[model samples]
Each structure stands twice: as structure tokens, then as C-alpha cells.
Target: MSNSVKTINPATGKVIREFETISDQQLQDKIEKTHEAFLDWKQRSFDERGALIRKVGDLLVENQDRLSKLITEEMGKPINQAPGELQLCQGICHYSADNAASFLADEERDLPGGRALVSHQPIGVIFGIQPWNFPFYQVIRYTIANLMAGNTVLLKHAPNVWGCAEALEDIFREAGMPENVFNVLYIQEDQASQVTEHKRVRGVTFTGSAATGRKIAAAAGEHLKKTVLELGSNDAFLVLEDADIDKAVDACVTGRINNNGQTCVAAKRFVVVDAVYEQFRDAYLAKMKQVEFGDPSDENTQLGPIAREDLRDNLHAQVKESIEKGATCLTGGEVPDREGYFYPVTVLENVTPGMPAYDGELFGPVASLIRAKDEADAIRIANDSVYGLGGGIFSEDEKRAERLARDHFDTGMVSINGYYIAQPNLPFGGVKDSGYGREHGGFGMREFVNSKSLMIAQ
Candidate 1:
């Protein structure tokens, strides 16, 4: 093992652990072993695999405290949020185990000339590159589904949360998963291309920025391996004339500030119709002002430090530049003098097209508010971006909001009168630059599987 990945305590800016990354030969060996493992694992009945998957879910719930603590310490997620992330990950296990068999079962069809069957078969080892935010859920979101489909997985998690990565791998092993069925590669980002190009690696899935996603997808495409990319998004939360201001504000605030506002699908843009823009603005500003930043380990802390100093600086730079380009800082723009990487909860108004806050993802505890002349303007403004991951529509008339969200909103996922990012039973991913392919629900289990047509009658 060569010293490479350094896990840091984001809350204290201290080194927690340094993992020795494996050599190229060792990585190749693991990929080969995972492929070998897949051969046997795929032969097991769905009931057999489902039973083991259920046990893994039970273990996750059973060890929630320790696992959640690891996430909170490694990445500065407020301790209160960590348990929910774990619970969501555990839900993925349960959902995948319960649904994979039916989702992937062979379909018997009647044809004009002969009978045919469609079978979902395992496609060897898939390589996953996950992000730092929502450490446990990010990995489990795709991994558990792939595993349930009988394809082994190799995870290349974010650098700052190495401990969470190892702990996840260990948990699966402890649950009696086959050796090398799920492995963690403590490799550098640069080394990822090699894994994609490896002959034994069947597919690759990544969750990160568009620039990085382009590179990974390119490498995987060159190898003719299937790829799933879940990149960043600047999702908009729209408040129409008839929206319930109190409820919308609460949901948008949670979407913006939760997990210290580092989520890929967090509601970054707030587009409100002119009729109630002022009312929404006042309430939203008041709530954001009340967010307290402190040690994430404290249960009462609503906001925690950004995962790293560089990330905090990047977020600040985006806010500063937006200010320079005519955006007004409504509140919480100034950087406070503090020990950890703490940035104030900022809200930028009068956000125009050219401003960074309007055109791009903030990726931190910053919100952008854009006023629209009417309902038409609100929908127009919401769709004006390169990203289309997730968005929300808040209105008292649920039917109208649902219709607009279904017909007009150009994003991959939308919530009516609320905010949501991940659900075990829903398909998760995005369109355009936000990345392609769907995960969760039944879609993820078949992402890397071989759907072959089995003809029966002569």
C-alpha cells in the first residue's frame, strides 16, 4: 500500500487518516477478482441475493450511530443530518432487495413467428466514482442496486471522506458479501481513467461536476463501456402567485442549507412571481438569518462548516463575483472569522442571466433569488440554464402546480410544494449537462445489466 488518500476532519481541519492507495497491478487484480466474484454471485437465485441484501440493510440500521458519526466527522455534515443519510442509504438496500428480482425478471413475450424472452443478465464489474456530499447515500444509491442485479462494484469516493469509504466497504464484507464483490479503490482522481479503460471493468458511473463527468464519460466511452453520469445542477424552486409562502420558505431553506448546502440537486435558484415576491423574500431572509453555524457534532447546530477550506473559498469567490456583477447580497455574504471552513448563509437578489449565481451551480450555503413578472416569466426563468437536474413548484393549487411541473419544467425530477433530492423508489439522474442515465427505482438495477433477447421456439 502506498500512502495517497488523506481523510481529513473537516470540522477541525485536522488529518483523521491517510490511506495507502493500491498499485496499478493491485487495482487490476481487484477488478479481475470482482469480475470473478460476479460469475458466482450471478448464479445465485434472486432469493439468495435478496436475503443477503436484506441482511446488509439490517446491519446498516443496526450500526447507524457509528456510521453516521463517521460521516459527520469526515465531512463536516451536521450530526443531525448524518443519521438521515444513513437511514436513506439503508432504505436503498431494502428497496433494491425487495424490488430487484421483479424488476429484472425475465419477460415472456409472444411473437408472430416464435416465442421470445427478455432476460436481464449481470454485466461483470462496474466502477463508481462518488462525491463527498452525502457520502454513504451517494455510494449506496448506485452500488446497492448494481449489487442486487448481481454485478460487482468498485468505488472511487471523494478524497476528503476516505474513512466513510472504507467503513462502507467493511460493512458489506461484514454482512457476508462475497470477497471482492464490493471494493473501495483509494486511488487518485487521475488514476480513474485507468480503471475505466481496464478490460474487466464493465461500466462506470460518476457523480460530480460536468467537467469531470465529461472526462470520465469520454474515457469510458472510448472503452465501449456503458457510463452513468450524475453531475451538478442549478435547480430552481419557483413560488407562484398562489403559493403558500410559509411552507415554500421552509422547504426551500432546508433544500438550500441542509448538508451545509453542498448537494448537487439542492435548490440553488429561487424564482418567485412578482405578486408575492416581497412576502417570500422577507420570510426566507428571516429563516436564513437564523441558521447557526458551529461544530457539526452538536445536535443543535443547524449549519456546519464547508467540507474544506478550498471549497469554502470557491463558494465565497462565486458569491463575491456575483456581487461584483450587479447582484445584491440580501444577507449573510460576509465571511466570518472562524476556525473551521465556515461561510455565512448568503442570499443574493436581483440575480440576472450573466451572474454566476443565476447561470451556474453555487454548490454551497448560498441562495439566489430572481423575481419574475408573472407565471409565464417564472417558468421561462426557471428553464433558462444548462442544468436540468431537479426543481420544485410551490402553489396552493396542487393540480395546477403538478401540471406545470410535468409539462413545463425541463428538469429530470420535480417536487410539488416541497423539496426532495433522493428517494429509493424514484429514478434519480438528470438531463442535458446534469448528466445522463437513471438510478434508483428499478432503473438502477438494470443500468449495467445485459438485456438479452432469448428466443425459445424454433
Candidate 2:
């Protein structure tokens, strides 16, 4: 495990730097030290924790330019989006700091015999497994909330963005976090098992593929430990007959292409009712085809390379399979003869059940177009998948559309007449194959806490 950790430049496919994976002894030491920190941290007042957390947010804002550049270099995120991502991280920190105390404050409950209070108390050290797509935002969403709740955190970020992981540890330390209150485990996947099984670790939160989430959950389950698994999604964006075509088209394009189409919540499937299918098809196709990929460092570049070569290969294979299974490519499908790990913006039509592009996630700049017979059929088509993470409905009547979104949409989150992503004050998670548990909003602060009940004698 000594030379196993490598951070690669996804845009150029170059070796950025290779680092040593910490030994079992080193990992054990980190675990112990972090556990020790949690003992003291758990006793601190919410005000004290909130103050420090706000400082973390301030620091992120101050360092946004530098850190954002690093994010782009490491992950091929377009320069314009990198700063936005960091700013969102700053928002998470502030949101957790400002609202966590109230969110987790002791609640007085009426008891039959005596007065009872439900207190949210820190459980212990929580381990996090984060992905690289939204490098800083992903970690901040979970860690900030937990920190405000007085739980020490351990993060094992994706190897491709290890630099960002280490930078986070430094940021926490700079913001006056207690020694070992936040830790970055420079360990591989196998080493993670050890961390999960460690007796001191209380809960685990993972944001990545469902396949990996299963492994982490199974490992933690064996110890009867709590786990929050926020996995992948193939979110459907439905275009109803009455939807504003102009608004719907723009939302669909942005929803699909944001984050180079690597986002878990990015709309992967477009379920349009037949009334406006042709207009939707033509507009979506033209806009999608116009997308261009260039150096992420370029401010003018609208799109960048996929995170890695294998990811690009996987996306192309999905497109190829969909085509072979009778789906027609409306736009970009073939891999471009480019230097970087890039795939052009693609749109597919005639996508149906059983095809990869239809049932599974494409995970790139590829959009699946599924036709529905009508409004009822569109809802059915949207909810026809195993994933229930996020979906959208566009309609002229906001009230009626919201009803469909609230009552008919089976996804954990839905949009009425627009697109949406993770918001700091909103509970973000999904049902079904997208994984279980919630993050963001106020709920995240208590996810790893012990909600102890205290009944006082009258």
C-alpha cells in the first residue's frame, strides 16, 4: 500500500503526483487520536462549535480562487464551475454553523408521567467516503453538519482528488479545529474495511456508487453501526404537454450538462409527453450538439473532459450498446478523436426499457430521450426506474405541476417547471437504488448524533 495513492490530472491523463498510502499502524493512530478528539469535542457548547465552523466558511471564501484552481487541475472541472463549487462549500459551512444549534437543540416532549427532553448528542467519530465530482462540496455537505453537531469526522476521499482531501485537513486545522477532530485517511479501499470495523468509529456516511455503498454498508452492518449511504441516481426530467417549451428545453440542457454530466442528480432521462415531443426533440438536439469541450482552464470552455479515461470509455460503451439495442443517436455518440479523456455532448432517442441508456445511468454528457403517450404516461415513464433520487416536471400551471411533483413523482426530490441540485438548507438523499439516508438541511446535523431521551421527575 506504500505507493498506491496517485492523484491524476483527468484533463490531460498525466501523473500529477503519487503518494504513499498510510500503513495500518498510521491509520490506527489516526483513528485513536480522532476518537480522543471526539471525547473533548462532544462537550463543547454549540456556540463555540458554530463560531469555529463559521471561520471555516470564511477561510473557504478567502481561499476559493486557489482551491478552485486546484480542483480544476485535479478533476477537469471547468474553471467557471470550480469557483461556484467552492462557494457552495462555503454556503454549507455557514448554513450548518448558523442553523445546527436550533436544528439539534433539546426538544421538550410531553410525557404521560413526567416531562421529557430529547437531546441531540454527539455519538463519536464518523467516517466518510466521498467522491471527486464536487470535490469540496461533497465532503463539506456531510462533514460540516456533523462537525456542528459535535461529531469528529474521518474522510477517505477518492484517490483522483487526494490533493483536495489533504487541503481540507489543513483548512480545518487552520480554522482552529481540535487536533485530529478532522482527519483525512490516506488509505486505499481495503484499508477502509479496517476503519469501518474499528470499535471506536460510530457511524459511516458514503457518497458514491451503489456498488461501493453496499460494501461499506455491509461492513458497518456487521458491527451493527449506523450508516448513511447516498449513492447514484438516474434522475428523470419530465416534459408535460402544457410545459413552457422554451423553459423546459433550457432546463433540460443545463440539467444534463452540468458537471460535465457526471453529477448523480443531473437529469439523465428526458420523459416528454407526445404533444410536444417533436419540438422538444429538435430544440434539445440542436442545443446539445452545439456543446464543445476544451481546456477546463479556459473560461470560455462550456464543457470539459470527463473525469477519467475509463469513465469516458464506459460512457461511450453505454452509448454504443444503446445504439445496438435499436436506440437512435440524435446527436453526439461516437468518441471524439481528441487528446484528453473527452466525449462530445450526446443525445439519444427511442430509448426504452432494457437498454443501458434507458434503465441504467449514463454518467456522462449523454442524455436519454424517452417518449410518453401523455401526461399520465409521462409520470409512469419517469417513475418506471429503480432509482428515485431526483426528477423534474415542467408545466405552465405551477400549482398543478407541483401537485404532480409532490404526489406523483416517486423521487426523493423533484422540481416543478425548473431544474434543481443540492441546496444547503434542503434535505438531500434518495430512495430505492439511489441509496438511503439524508444529507444537507438540518437533518444532516443529527444523522450521526445520539438523540438521547431524558425524563425528569416532577
Candidate 3:
């Protein structure tokens, strides 16, 4: 229970900066101010809101270099990939600003005796608890949509990315957003719990682990408040009997190691049919072994250190436990003898249900390879996990792959013949243990809004 938030550079394992947490009284004042701002904000026209939101996107473009560097320094995302995260954030803001009006406009419907109108209206202040994995994108994912929906926002970002949070607040300010329309909370866990209960806070949105998402859902449920949770995933990538082995290997390698494999939707499991298992495994392992790990800022570094020492330790522990439980390590399971919190790109074979590598998220540069009897078994293995966030299918038969992805993937989203990340126009989120609700597309703009029905008789 420290009184201040300290950020560390995972590349050097050194403290970057420290900022003091706000007092309880300050927290209360900020909440009140945000709610007050929401009252006026919700009354403004969508065009007005959209104009301001578009400015936020413009600011992101203007400051991409500085902000991307900040992201790499704070969270250990490779410098090359950090800009891509901001690029996604920029798209989110622009998309929300452009489409939210049409998405939230009133709709005319036929009623028993007359016409009915359904209008989506903003509630009030929405509180978001986001992770550090994609600092800018995570915040923008929720914030822009809520703002476009006319609700003021309060963010309790991960402590390790407090600097990113503050930078966002500053960006909103510079974009001429009214005071207190978007606020960042520098508070402890206990304080966050209290904020969730505040009467002014109408809804909650969280992105993190399933265990923590449950706690958030429970806390919000006690008050009968609305919530949207986007939790973790051990996503699977399938290789069918007629799949393109080289194509699958290239995509799978990038899918697992991108962001140094810290992505929640990153492909963790490779389920290959017996026909292609050996080929896929051999090529996948060879490429994974060649991933260059170094300082995040280095242009040639393909893999950077984990976000923190403890996360690296936890990832290594999972690898060890999986090895002890009968999984075979093919490459890069050892922590490197380096200065930073570096773990090499690892590949594990023969992963089964009882092992951590099979059942849980590694959250680092580790890949799990599972052999399947055939395409049916591969599909079964992919759906076997409690998480259903996102998964992939690789096959030469596009029609068959599409059929499986559309009908049997059992996840919020699926990729056909390759891998993909979050898209501003597509829905994101998961089911079962991966948490509930959807973001991006038009769904996020309506997640926290009220749809009121009006009956009219002529």
C-alpha cells in the first residue's frame, strides 16, 4: 500500500518516475466534477461531441512519436510496435467520432397501437479500469466511445502506465475538451472500489484477467450497476490437413511473439492436424528460436523484455510447471542471463489439458503446440478452453475455414487463414471466462448508454 505510483522501465529494470496518489477528498471532488460535466455533455449535440473527439485523434497523430516512445519506455513494448498501438488508438477516436451519431440516433419502430421511438441516451460518469499491455489503445478503446456517447469518463489505469494515463488527460485538455470531462484517478485498489460505488458513477468497464474481472463484476453487481468486462484469452490457432504450412508458420510466429507475446488475444495454442503437425512444429520452432531479444528501442530487436520483473518470473514459472507436467520444451524456455527482464521466445510441444501451458495464459513469448488426430480434433481442442475471446483457422479451403469460423469457433471473433488484431470497425470482447460485452464497431458506443422507448399515438 504505497502512497505513490511508481513506473519502471522493463528494458533497464529502473524506476522511470513516481507520482503521488490523490487524496480521498480529491478523488471525491473529481468524481463530482465529472458527473457535473456529464450533465451538460449529454445535452450537447452529437456533432459537437464528434468535433471535439476528432480533435483528439488529430492530437494523437501530431504527437505519435513522443507518445509511442513513452509507451515503449513505460510498458516494454518494442519501439517498432509501440507506434502501431497508437495508430490503432487514432483509428478508434476517428471512427467513434464519425459513426457514433448514426449508431446512437433514435430509431422508429412499429408498436401495437402506434409508432415507437427508441433513443440511446448517455447515463452519467463511466469508470474504466484498464491494463498496461496496450496503454493508449486500451484507454482510447473505452474512453472515445463513451465520450462520443456523451458520458464523461473516469479512468483508473494500471499503476505501471500512469504516465500514459496522464498524457491522455493532457491530450484531451489540449484538444479543448471541457474541464473534468475526462479524468484520470491515481488511487489504490481500496479507493478504486469506493469509486465504483459512487452514486455519480453509472457504469463500469474493465479489461484485465478473468479473476480480476470477476471481482470487478461482483463489486459492480452488488449495486445493480451496468458493467462491461474484457478479460484474458489463451487464443488458439488451428492448422488444418490442407493448410499452407509456410503461411501458417509465418502468421503464427508473428501472432505469438508480437508485443513480445503480451497480447491478450495473441495466439498461444497451435493445434495442428497430424498431417501437418510435424511440418508446422519444425518450422514454427525454427523461426521462434531466431527471434532477436534486446533493448526495446533497438530497431533490430524483434522481442523486448516483459513489462516487469514479476511478470517475467510468472511466465517462467508457468513454463517450468508445464514442463514438469509432461510438456516438452523445444526452444527458448530459459530466462536469459541479461540485464533486463528478458525471457526468450519459447516453444512447448505435447501440451495437454492438465498443464499450465495448455490451460492458462502465458502472457509472454511462449508458444504451445498440440497434435490433433484431424481437423475435427483441432476444432474440439480450440473450443476446449474456458476463454472464447479470439481464435484462428488456417486452411487452403477458404470456404471450409469460413464455415468453421462462422459456425463453430465459439468465440467473440475469429481469423480465417491468418491472424489479425483489433479493428476499429469490428466488434471486440469475449464470452464465458473471457468476460462479457463488446467494444469497437458501433457496439462500444452503446455499451453504457440507455435505450429509452417512447410511444406515440396519432
Question: Residues 224-255, candidate 2, lDDT per residue (tens digit)?
Answer: 99999888888999898888998998999999
Q: What is the lDDT of candidate 3?
A: 0.93
Candidate 3 TM-score, C-alpha based: 0.99
**Among these predicted structures, which one has the highest lDDT?**
3
In model 1, where is the ten-residue run with the lowest total lDDT?
Answer: 1-10
lDDT of 3 by residue, 308-375 (tens): 89999999999999999999999889988878899999999999998989999999999999999998
Report the Cα RMSD per candidate: 1.2, 1.0, 0.8
Ranking by lDDT: 3, 1, 2
Local distance difference test, each candidate = 0.90, 0.89, 0.93
Per candidate, the number of residue pairs that clash is: 0, 0, 0
What candidate 2 gets wrong by more than 4 Å, as runs, is none
Q: Is candidate 1 or candidate 2 better by lDDT?
A: 1
Return whichever of 2 and 3 wins on lDDT. Answer: 3
Report how far off residue 442 is in candidate 2 (Å): 0.4
